[model samples]
Structure formats: C-alpha cells, structure tokens
Target: MLESVLLAGGGSAGHVNPLLAVADELRRRRPDVRVVVLGTAAGLEAELVPAHGYRLVTVPRVPLPRRPTLDWFRLPGRLRAAVRVAGQAIDRSGAQVVVGFGGYVATPAYLAARRRGIPVVIHEQNARPGLANRLGARWARAVAVTFPGTPLPGAQVTGLPLRPQVAELVAARHRDAGRARTEAAALLGLDPTLPTVLVTGGSLGALSLNTAVAGVAADLLAAGAQILHLTGAGKADAVRAAVAAVTRDARPGVALRYQVREYLAEMHQALAVADLVLARSGAGIVSELAALGLPAVYVPLPIGNGEQRLNAGPVVQAGGGVLVADADLTPQWLRSHVIPLLADPDRLAAMGAAARTVGVTDGAARVADLVEGLA
Candidate 1:
C-alpha cells in the first residue's frame, strides 16, 4: 500500500479542516493509499479524524505556556514523549512520506519522519507561517503556501484546499447561476426575497465579530436582512443572550430573521446564501469566500501577526470586500458598511462576482500532486 502520514493536532477547526481536505484529495487520487493522522488526545481530531474515516493516532502533548511558569518544566518530557509516539506510529504505518499541516503536534511527527529517513512536506496555510511549520521547514522536502507571497524557498503557492461541498458550489455557479442561488438559499433556510449576511470567525468563531454583529442586530433586522451566525462553542450562549436583548428592544411586528449555531456542519449552505460576509480574514476563510463568489467585510485580527491582514489585501483590492482594522470595528462601522450593500443589490452582486475571480479551485489537486510525486 502507498502509505502517507498527516501530522495535525489541537482542537482548532482551522488546522484540522485543511488536513482533512488534503487527505480527502489524496484518497480521491489513490484509493488504495493508507493514510494515518497523528494528533493529540485533547484535540478535536479525536472526533473529527475518525468521523472522516481515517485512523487517528493520539499522543500526550501540551502547549508551552505563554509566560514562564512551572509548565515549562514539563515541556521537555512532553516533547520526548510526543517524538516517541510519532516514531511508533510511523513505523507501524510504514509511511513513505509525512505531511504536516502545522500545529504543536506536527513537530514530533516531522522529526520522527526525518529520523526514519522518510521524506517530509510542510503545508503553511497562513501568509505568515506559524512557528511549528517554520521549524519543520528546515527538514521539509517542499513547503506549500496558501497566499500569493510567502518567502520560503521551494515553497509552491498551492492556495487553500476547500472541502468538496465548496468546490461543487463554485462549479454550480459557473454552470447555472440562478439555480445555484436558489439551491443554496433552500439549503440554508434563507428566504429568497431577503438579503443574507454570513457572520463567522474560523470554525470556532470570533468573539469580536459576534459582539459587533449582536450590537447591530437591530439595524439589520429593521432593514429586513437575514443573518447566519456561527458562534464558537465557548461563546454561543453569550451571543444568543445578546441577540435576545436586541430582539427584545426592537420595534414590534418586525421579524428579526436569523439562525445561530455553535458550529456550521454545512458550510456550503451558509456560503451559498450569503450576499455579504462579515468575518475575520484568515487565509482559509478568504480562500472560501473567493471560491464561492461571496463578498465580505474583513476585519483582520489585531494580533500584529500580519497574516490576516495580508490575506485580506487581495480581496479588498479586487473590490470584493472592504478591510476594516480590528481596532476600527464598531457597531456603527458595521452598520454603515453592511447596510449600503444590503440596500443595493447591484453592488452586492458586483462584489460577489469580483470575489469569485480570486479563488483557485484546483488547489487541492495541486497540493495532492505534490504529495503524490513525493511517493
């Protein structure tokens, strides 16, 4: 069997989803291939990987504390344990190649593969590479990037690999525009007569985005626009409470149409129905927006990493969306930016059209080709 190992960990859907996408693509190209994923027991991978039909190998790994603390003492032990687990997994799987999608758990897997003389590849999804991927790059046979300008040598810009549902949505738009819109709306429970705005962070959701959208819920409702909000599990209750307060204070007889969920299992439904999107500009999110022909109001996280900001630039420049600094985000600014587009159907349509022009639909195939060639 052609064996490959994918190294990804942590509960963040952002990291896990991309690894899953690449795995799916790899399977499509080579059905007989044996793919094993290495992650931690504490991560979402425990649930997500097996649900996607892959064998998951878990290790005991903990993240380094942000500040100097007693946890620092455990770092060395954890690293050694992780490395041992990875070595065992690699040997058991007999992997020919190891692909890391960048997380704390990826380090050990990469190192194990290197020790065993197996070829290693690193895929960096952010414009600014994460620390794990940066460290892994030294041993990587090749590095894959999602954005236009990443500075690693032998790095191929393969773009982000979207889920199959997203790819189908893009294809449908090209083949039959009206049918695509109608079908998307139906799938999302959206009223065909009303304009829709999609609000989300990554798969987990952004607190600031949720707060700002909550503050402006009244205005959006007054204008007869609908909302699809994905509040991360941790903050869903708070966001729902805020929305309730907004609805309670709204004018009587006006229906505030919205659907709020802790996670979006059917992302295609949200993307299909969205005329405008309010979100943070992660590289993966930007790629999906571009692929689906959805316009967005991008608020780059103000963490000073510059990754989100870099990801949003192309879409803003393409006239598909406006970039608002996180510090500049307020209910007033959101209302101003979103209200006009909702009121003007032509402007929304134009933005969506422009956004679609920026997507690389064949990203998965390209990355898969790279991985397959390594074998």
Candidate 2:
C-alpha cells in the first residue's frame, strides 16, 4: 500500500469535493497514510483542504487559454514555474503516488510526478474529459472516470466520488428508503408524505431554471405537490416575486406550499426528502441523484462544450430521468410534463428504480483501490 499520496485539483467544488472524497476514503482505509493536497491559493482548495484537516501546498494559478491569446504564448514559462513548485511539494511529502482530479493544477502535478518517477493516477468527473485530464491520461498509471464511454485511454468507470454527507445518505437510503426520507424531511421542515420537487441550478444558480420553475409554482401547488426551490445565491427574491405575482389572486394556501431558499448548507438533506429533482445535469449532481435513486429532470446548461448534456445522457437513456434543453424548460413544459408526472406515484417509483440501476455508491473506495494498486 502507498504510504503517502499527493492529491491535485481545485478551482471549483466539482474538482475539490471529489478530490477530498478520495482523500477521505484513503485515510479511512489506511489510517497511517500521509495525504497532501496541491492547489492554487485562488481556488476553493485554499479554504476547503485545510478545513478537512489535510496539508495543502499551493502553486500559482495557471490557466491554459483555449483561444490563441497572449497568455497562450506565456503558458510554457508559467507552467514550468508551477511544475517546479509542484515537484518540491511532492518530494517533501514523499508521495508514493500522485492522484489528480483535473483542474488548472493537474498538469503541473502530473509533469512533476513524472519527473520524479512517481506513479500518477487521474480521476475525471465528466463524461467529456477536461483538457488537463485528457493530457495527463496519456501517461497516467491509472485513469478513473465517473461516467461510461469517457474518451480517456485505459479509463475505468469508477463513478464520481461523492461527498461524505451524500455517501452517508446513500447508505441510509439503502437501509430503509422510506424511513430515511421521512427523517430527512423532518429535519428540513417538509411534510414527509408530500410529493416534493427540488429545483436547483447548483451554487451559482441558473436564471433560466429559476424563472421557468417560478413561473409554474402555482400550478405545482394546485396539483398537491410541494416546491423546494433553491434559487442559487442572491436570486431568491426574484423567484419569490415571480411566484407571488402568479399566485397573488389565487388561494391563500398556495404560498404555504412553495418554499424558496438561496442555498442549503446540507444539500444531501434536501436530496433525501426530494421525490424528484429538476436541476442542471452537472456530473456531481447527476451522480448524486442517481446514487440515491431519485428521479430527475435534467436541464443541461446552454454553455460549455455540451458536457452537461453528455453527463445526463446515460441516466436519461436508462429511463431514470428526463433531459430538457435550457431554452425549452419553460412554464408550459412544466405544466405539460412535470405536474402529471408528480401525480403518478407508480411512474415516479419506476423511474427511481431505474435510476438506482445506474447509480454507484462505492466510487470513492474504487478510486482508492486503484491508487493503492499503483504503489
């Protein structure tokens, strides 16, 4: 077994969270292992890595420009400096193997590890691999991917490494799903028996998703279904206003059925109580919902390289979820499709069952096993 590991990734929660998950699993499995994280001071890891009780070494943030810009010309010098620092950190940690989660820091970490003749392991969270991982995969000792058909050479489908809260929730659901949902509902102040729909666009919020869902809040409440709209940060007031405008002349009880919050600290709690989720189909959320066997309506972000759509493809094709384009997710779409689906418990149950078939709960452990094999 490896005595120490150097974990590299950061910038966003998508990379940092999974890197931490794998680190947690490694520590849990081998208590004596030394785990060190390499990240940039500007990234989420500067805050989260230390909070998780791991040693973090930071290198300058080096972004590889996509278009031919002046920064592209300066890439080699910046990358070399980053790699030099990365090598020093690796040597100090005496890492037996380096595990990378594909972010700005990964290229330097991979090159540094290779220079020292250290084995490198990579974990790609998206179906469409990022530039860093795509480059690292060429020489990585092992490549683990969250989704099937990821175009990485010698990649293994290890699933996304879930956060601890999500992993625990998956275990609880496996033990007794109804009981778990009820307990989680109680904690979240939600009625356990209500058919609840969770609408979110991740932490930054999606204006399109919020507007579309808010436009149909009254209709959902009228169908005896409740709404838990997590309207990203700084966007709740707008959603609230939209819902209020639609239901102003209607029943007094309508407002009581709609809940709007900017964010939930414990998102797994919301996931546990949610019967169905309508949100962006990012790799993290998609894998988390699938792991819990909750049906979802995936709205792929209109931006990016279309990776969000690719991430939701497997679950949708498996009959576990529905995919809608961001532009097409209007009020009419919700009234036409979502309301009726909420009313049909049998169909909802079937969809959840199908989702479970594609879910993976042991991803962290699988990735850890792969890392251990390298040493």
lDDT of each: 0.81, 0.93
Q: Give the true-structure RMSD of model 2.
A: 1.1
Off by over 4 Å in 1: 1-10, 62-72, 234-253
Error of 2 at 45 (Å): 1.3
Question: Cα RMSD (Å) per model?
Answer: 2.7, 1.1
Model 2 local distance difference test score: 0.93
- Against the true structure, candidate 1 reaches a TM-score of 0.90
Residues 5-81, candidate 1: write the lDDT tens digits.
55555556667877888889889878878899998787888898999999999987756455789889988898889
> In candidate 2, what residue range of length 10 has the lowest lDDT sum?
249-258
The local distance difference test score of model 1 is 0.81
* Cand. 2 TM to true fold: 0.98
Which candidate leads in lDDT? 2
